[model samples]
Target: MEGADWLRTRLTSLHCATCGRSYRDGQIRVRAQRDGLSFVDFVCRACGREANAIVTVVGRGRAARLEVGELAESPPGARSPSLGPADVLAMRRFLRRFNGDFRSLFGADGRAGGRLGA
Candidate 1:
């Protein structure tokens, strides 16, 4: 998928570091300043504090990591994408539905299948 869509699909809301309040995807403004990454700016609605975030593309799957920091930093080459509350919930649901079926969970053509000589 294209950079903008990829970013939008992977990014969820981030919580306020100071107040522990959460902000939605639409409430925050994100800009793709780099190649396939995004520079996210989050403004806390309650306390009016702003946070700088970076979203980077990692592996082949539809996963991306959202890193929130006080200032923008160079993207780390490859790291597990950060999970928001929504992502965690979705993962729980996936595990529930695909219980014990590793192939179904990771895909039959996934690396795990290939590695196991399946």
Candidate 2:
């Protein structure tokens, strides 16, 4: 089968990262195709956001199979939380007199140096 056909079939069962809505066949559009590879775009009808994917077809005839190379960027809200102001302040305080010696900072006696409470 073609790369686009395989991708549409696979993507239809997956949900969008932003809106959590399953992708439909109509929502997928093939942007480019060459050899056994295709670049496709998915526009979510629910959130009206767009995502891109790279798909590849390996082998031939009955042995042909589809593989997803990469998907679009994940939703920003799903990322790990960033360090807060308090964390920055604590790091600054610890670095004030740090001699850049990791071994001494970590302590030779299994104790964290820099006055880090055990």
Candidate 3:
């Protein structure tokens, strides 16, 4: 199954961080995908506000770790193309070449270190 579909199957329910509106599995929608993660964003059916979800499955198959985090805002609009396997490999390559420059990796706000913008 695709990342989003897998996450949907795994999740029982979710709620909007901004509005406290509850969401069943079918209410969420994928806005982005990278690696074993899916970024889902939608207008809350209850409060009519935007909500974001970062659903990730680490490892593979049955041993994977499924994580879901609420985002204050939707993810950044597509900066480039949709993520793919090749993009993940390229990211791994980039990180491998990283010289541990914290500022360069995370930018001035250190937002890139986590889900700050989204």
TM-scores of the models, in the order given: 0.44, 0.52, 0.48
Could you arrange the candidates by lDDT from highest to lowest? 2, 3, 1
Alpha-carbon lDDT, every model: 0.59, 0.74, 0.68
**What stretches of model 1 exceed 4 Å from their correct place?**
1-10, 61-118
Compared with the true structure, model 1 gives a TM-score of 0.44
Q: How would you encode candidate 3's per-residue C-alpha lDDT over 43-64 as one tens digit per residue? A: 5667656656688777787887
- lDDT (10s digit) by residue, model 1, range 1-118: 2456445444545577768778666646665557656677665678766666766655545454554445432233322357899999998997677648667545587766542454
* Clashes by residue pair, model 3: none
Of 1 and 3, which scores higher on TM-score? 3
For TM-score, the strongest prediction is 2
lDDT of 2 by residue, 1-118 (tens): 4656666776687677789998899988777888777887777889877777887878777787677666695353543467999999999998897778766666666478534534
The global Cα lDDT (0 to 1) of model 1 is: 0.59
